[model samples]
Target chain A: MAYTIELFMVSVGVGLISGALINISIGYKFHNKGGLIGGLIVGLLMAIL
Target chain B: MIEVFGLNLLGLIGLILFFGVLIASLRGWIPQDILPVQSALMLTAFILIILAFILGKPIGLKDIQMNIYLHPITALIAGFLVAGALEAAGAFKAAINILEKLSKTTLGLPGTVVILVNIPTIFAMPCGRILAAALIPAAILFGYILAREHKQPALASIVVFGFIVNAAASCGPSPLGGIGMVGEGMAGGLGVAGVQLGSFVNAQQIAIMMITAVTMLSMSLVFKITPDELLIASEEKAEEKREKKEGVSREGYISFFFFFIGIAIVFITQPPIPIQTILIFFVVVIMLVAKISVKDLIGGVILHPIMAMISGFIIAGALVAIGSFDVMIQILNVLAQTPLGYIGVAVLIANIPTILPMPCGRIIAMALMPGILLFGLRMTEIGLPEIATPILLTAFIVNAAASCGPSPLGGIGGIGEGNLGTAIGSSGRPQQVGIMIGTGIAAVIISFFGFI
Candidate 1:
C-alpha cells in the first residue's frame, strides 16, 4: 500500500513537471520568457518539496 | 443585516463575482477564443489577488504558486502532446484505416462502430478533440458508405453520434493518458485516504466501459438499428477504390509500433518510470521517426488547451486563496448530510459540464474534482460508508468529463458539427441531449451500484 501511494505521488509529480515543461515551451514560443522562468522556478520548488 | 443566504457581505460579494465569471464564461459572453480560458483564469486570479489585498489577507505569490501545482496540469499537457504526436504521425489514421477495413469484413458496420467508438479507451490520451479529428472523419465516411448502400442517411448519422458519445465517455477511463490521468491526478491530490491512483484509474475505466456499452446499446435500440443494416457491405469495386485511395504509409506503421509499445509499458510496469516520462520518450521517438522538427512538436503541444488549463489552475488557486472553495465545501457538507441532498449533489456534479457548457469543461471538472472529493472525504469523516465516497466521486468525475460530448460548446460537439456541416444548435443538439441524458443515466446507475 505504501508503495502504491508512492507510485501515485510519483505519477502526479511527473504530470506536474510535464505540465510545467509544456508551459515553459509555449512561453518560449510566444516570447514570454518571464513566464517560463517563473514556471521553472515553481517547478524546481515543487520538486524539492 | 447585509448577509444573504447565510453569507456575510464579503462572502456574498465573492460568491456573486465567482458565479458571474462562471456564467459569463459558460454563456459564451466572454469570447474565449480571443481572451481564452487561460486569460479569463488569469484575470480571475488578479481579481482574487485584489480581493485578498482588500480583505487584509493578501495572498502571496508563493501561496498561489503552491496551489498551481496541486492539479495535474502536467499530466494533461503530456497527454495532449502524446495524442498530438500520435495524430501527427498518422497513428490514429492508421487505426481508422484498419478499423475501416474490418468494417468491410464479416464483422460489419456495427462491429466497426463499436471498435471506432472504443478506440480512444485504448489510446486514452487527454485531448478528445484530436481523437475526434481522426475518428469523426472515418465515422462520417463510414456513415456515407452505409447511406450509399442502404439509402438511409439517418442511420449513418445515428451511428456517427453513437460513436461520438462512446469516444467522449472513453476519456474518463483512458488509463494510458487523456482525462483519466487528470482525474487520477486530481483524486490523488485530494488525499482520499487509502485510494490508489492507478487502481482508481482502472476502476473508472471499468465503470466508464459499462456506462458506454449500456448507452450505445440503448442508442442502437432507439434508432432501430439492427446488426444486419450495419453489416451490409459496400460494393466490392467501391471497397477496392477506397483501399487504393487510402493506403497506410510506412511511417504510420512505425507510429503504431511506438504507440503500442508505450501502451505495453504502461500496462506491464504501471508507473515503473512515470507515465509522463514514457509518453515523452515515445513522443520524442515519434518525432524523430516521422521527421517532425522540434518546432513542429512544440506547435503540436501548443495547439492543446494548455492556456485554458493553466488559467483553470490559476483560477482554482485564486478561488482557494479567496476561500471560495471553503464556502463551497460548507454548502456541499450541508447537502451531503441528507440522502436527498446527497443525491442532488451527485446529480448536479455529474451534469456540470452540460450545465456549464465550455470547451474547457474537462479542465473545469479537473479543477472542481478536488473540492468534490474533499466533500466526499468530509462525508467519510462524518461516518459515511468508506466505499460510498470513491464510488460517488468516480461517478461524478466520469459524468462531468463524459457529458462534454453533448454540449455545442464542447470540444467533441464542435468536431461533430464541423463534420456534419450543420450548426450544433440545430443538428447536433438532439444528439448532444441524447448523449447527456444517456451518460446521466449511466452516472445514476454507477452511483447506485457503487460498482467501483
Candidate 2:
C-alpha cells in the first residue's frame, strides 16, 4: 500500500502538480494545455507501471 | 525546564527566535548586512546557552562541537578547491568553446541553447557561484546572439535567467559539499545498507533538466523579461569582459579532461575512502597540470556559506541539547494524524526550504536536517515504506539546494540580475515556479526509479 501510494506520488501526483503550476504561472491562458494533458497521460502510464 | 507544546520553554523560544531572525533577514524586515543570518544564528545559539545556564540546563560546548558534521563540510571545501583550480586553469573555457562550436551543429541554436543553459547542472558544482561565474559571460553572449537571431529581446532573458536558475539549483546534485550530501549523510545514518553515497545524483540531474526548461518557458511566457528593458550601462562592460578572454590554453583542456575523469572514477568505484581525500588528490593533479598555486586555491573558498553552515550546526546542536528535535518530531507526528495525514505533511515538510528560502540553502539544510531525519524515522515507524525515506530526503534536499535562486538576499540569482541590470527580485517568481515543479519531479523520479 505504501509503495503504491509512493508510486502514484512520483507519477500522476507530480504530473498533476506540475501541470497546475505551469498553468498558474502562465495565468491560465491555456496555451500549454497540450503539455498538461500529455503530462497527465504519461504520468498515469508511469504510475501504472 | 518549563514545557510548552512538547518543547521546553527555552527551546521553544530558541527555535522561534532562530527561524524568526533568519526569515526576517531574508525578507529584508531587518538590515541583513548588519545582522546576517550567520551572525544571527550564532547569537541565537549563544542566547540559548545563556538561558540554558540560567535555567540549569546548560548545553555543553563539546555537545555542540560533536553535532557539527565535518565530513560534508570538508568535502564541500575540497570540492571548491578543485573547482577553483579548474577555473584558474581555464578548464571551463575549453568547455565553453565546445558548446560554442556545438551551437552550429545539427542540434542548432535551440538544442545547443538547452544544453548551454543546463551546463551548471551537467557539471554539478559544489557551489553554483563557481559555474555561474565561469559561464555567465557565455550565457550573456549566447543570450545576445539568441535575442538578435530570434528578434525576440525576451529570448536573452530566457537564456540568461534559465542558465542562472539551472546553475543555482545544480548544487543540489553536486557530489561535493552540496546540500544533497547533508541529506545523504542523514539518510545513511538510518543504517540502511546498499545506500550509495551519491544515490540522489541522477534524480536531481533529471529534475534540473526539466527545471531549466520550465524556467526558460516561465521567463518567456510569465515574466516576459526583456534584455532591452533590463539593459544597464554595465552591459557594455559585460561585453568587454567576454571580448577580453583569449583562446583556451592547452592546460585548460588537460585539467578539464582530468576533472570529469576524477568525478567519473569516484562515482563508478564508490571507494570506501572519504570523498575529501579523493577531491584533494584531484586538486593536486589539477594544480600541477594547470600550474595553479595553493594561494589560488585559497581564493576559491567562499566563507559566507561555510560560516552559515557552522552557525546552523551550532544552533542545531543547541536545539538538540534543549530537546527541540523531540518537540519538532512530536509536532510532525501530530500533524501526520490530522486530515492532511502523513503523506501530505511529508510533502509540505519537504518543500519548506523553498517556501522559506534563504540566501544560502546550506543554512536551512544543516539546521533542519536532523529534524527532517527524525521525522522520516517517525514516518517509517508509522509504516511508511523504507523507500520513502530517500524520496523525502531527495525532494527536500533538491528544494533547499534550489531555494537560493529566488532569494532576495545575496543568492546566486543576484549575480545574474546584476549582470542583466534587472531588479533584485525580478527573476524570483519564475525561478521559484520552476524550482517548485522541479522538486516535485525530483521526488517522483527518486520514487519511481527507486534511486534509494
Candidate 3:
C-alpha cells in the first residue's frame, strides 16, 4: 500500500509539472499591456468556479 | 436516441453551434471582416430554441411546456440591445470630455486613469469570457496607444495584470468573479464548499499573496513601464490611453463596492449567505445602474435568472437523454475514493478530456462529484479533512490556473499578448514580446507554487 501511494504521488507531480509548463508557455503571450487583465480574468474564473 | 435529420437532440444541437462558428469565421475570409460576433451568438441561441421546441417542447410559461433554452436566447438579446443602445447613445463619451480637460494638466491622463479607473475592472470582470469582453477590447486599444508613445508598458500592464489574476485567483464564493467559481467547483469536487473548507481552514491566501507580488513584478519586466516612463509620456499617446473614466453609473459604483464588502463578510461574518445570492444582488444593481429600464430588466431576468441557465437546462436534458446523472455520479464516487490525492486525481481527470480539447474542471461535476463525496467519507474514516486542508487548497489553486494563450483557441496566454505586440495595429511593438513573455512566465511560475 505504501509503495503504491508513493508511485502515485510521483506520477501526479510529474504530470502536473509537464502540464503546468505547457500552460505557462502558452499563457506567456498574455504578459503585455492588458495581459495582466486578460490572465487575471481567466485566473479569477478559475478561482471562483 | 432517435435520429432527427441524422442526429439526436444533443448531437444535432452541438453540430449547429459547431457549424455556426465555422460559418461565422468563414465570412471573415471573404469580407476580410469578421461577422458581427453578435450575429453568430444570436444565431446560436436562435437555433438552440428552435431545436428545443421542435423536439417536443410546448409553449407558454407553464414550466414544463416551455423550452428551457429560451432563457439564454432572450438574455443574449436583451444584453446586446442595451449595450448597443448605450454605445450609440455615447454615454461614455459624454463622461470622457470632462476627463480630457483634467488630463491636460500636470498630473497627465493615463497616470490618473490607471489608479482610480482601471483598478476597478479587476473587480468588475468576473464572469471571465463574456463579462471580460467589455473591457478586453478597450484594454487592447489602450495598450496600442501606450506602445505608440515611448512609454514603457509595465505600469499599465501591472494594473491590468492585477485585475486578471485577482479575478482568477479571487477567493470566497462570490459569483461577481470567475475565481470564486473556480474555487467552488474545485472545492465541490472534493465534497466541500469553497468558502468553508478550502478557504476557512487553509493558508492558501498566503501563497496567493506571494504569487501575486511576483506576478506583478514580472508583468512590469517588459515595456520597461517603470514609474519613470509615466512622467515622461505625460502627454500625447500616453494621455490617449490615460483619460480618467467618469463615473456615469453611480449605482454601479455603490453596488460593486458593496459586492466587495459582501465577499469580505463571507469570511468574517456570521450565518454565511450563499455567494450566489450576493452575485444576484450585484448583477441587479449593475442592471439598474447601466440604466437598463425596469421593464427590460424584468424581461431579461425572466429570460435568464441564472447565469448560463440555458446551458444548465440543456445539460440536464442531455443527462436524462444519455441515461442518468446518478449513474455518472456513482462512477465518479468510485474513482475519487481510490486513495488518490485530490490534486493528482483532479488533474488526471481534467486532462483526460484535453485530447478532445475540451475545457477543464467544470463539466465533471455531474460525473466526478459523487465520487468526491464518497471519498469524503474516507476523511471521517481517518480524520483528515482538517489535517489536509493546506494541501487541498494548493491543489485547488493549481487547478484554477488555466488560460488561452499562444494557441489559436483563445487561450488565456494569447489574450494577454493580444494587446502587447501583434494585437496593437500598424506601428505595433514586436520588440516588446521577449520582455512580456519573461514577466508572464515568472508570474505563472510563482502562481504554480501557490501565492504572489
Candidate with maximal lDDT = 2
Arranged by DockQ with the best first, the candidates are 2, 3, 1
TM-score of candidate 1 to 2 decimals: 0.76
- Chain B, per-candidate TM-score: 0.83, 0.95, 0.45
Return the lDDT, model 2, position B422.
77
Write candidate 1's Cα lDDT for B287-353 as tens digits.
8888766665555564445665566666666666666776777777677668857656756665666
Tens digit of lDDT per residue, candidate 3, span B296-381? 43432312113223333344343333323334334444556787654345444333212111121122222222233333444444
Clash pairs, candidate 2, are A10-B444, B76-B177
Better of 1 and 3 by lDDT: 1
Cα lDDT tens digits for candidate 2, B1-452: 68875556876777788778877887788788788877888888888899899988888899799789898789889988988899889898888887778767654555455556666876788888889888887787777776776567666777788788888888887878887887777678767533556777767766766676687677766688755544632564555566466778999999998987777666656778887888999889998898999998998887877887888888899888887787777777788889989899888988888788888888888888888888877777888788777777888888888888888888888988888777888888888888888888887887767762
Candidate 3 TM-score restricted to chain A: 0.43
lDDT of 2 by residue, A7-29 (tens): 55555544444444333332333
RMSD of each: 12.8, 5.8, 12.2
Candidate 2 segments exceeding 4 Å error: A1-49, B5-7, B228-245
- Tens digits of per-residue lDDT for model 1 on A1-49? 1223433433333323333332222112222333233323322222221
Model 3 TM-score, 2 decimals: 0.43
DockQ of candidate 3 against the true complex: 0.04
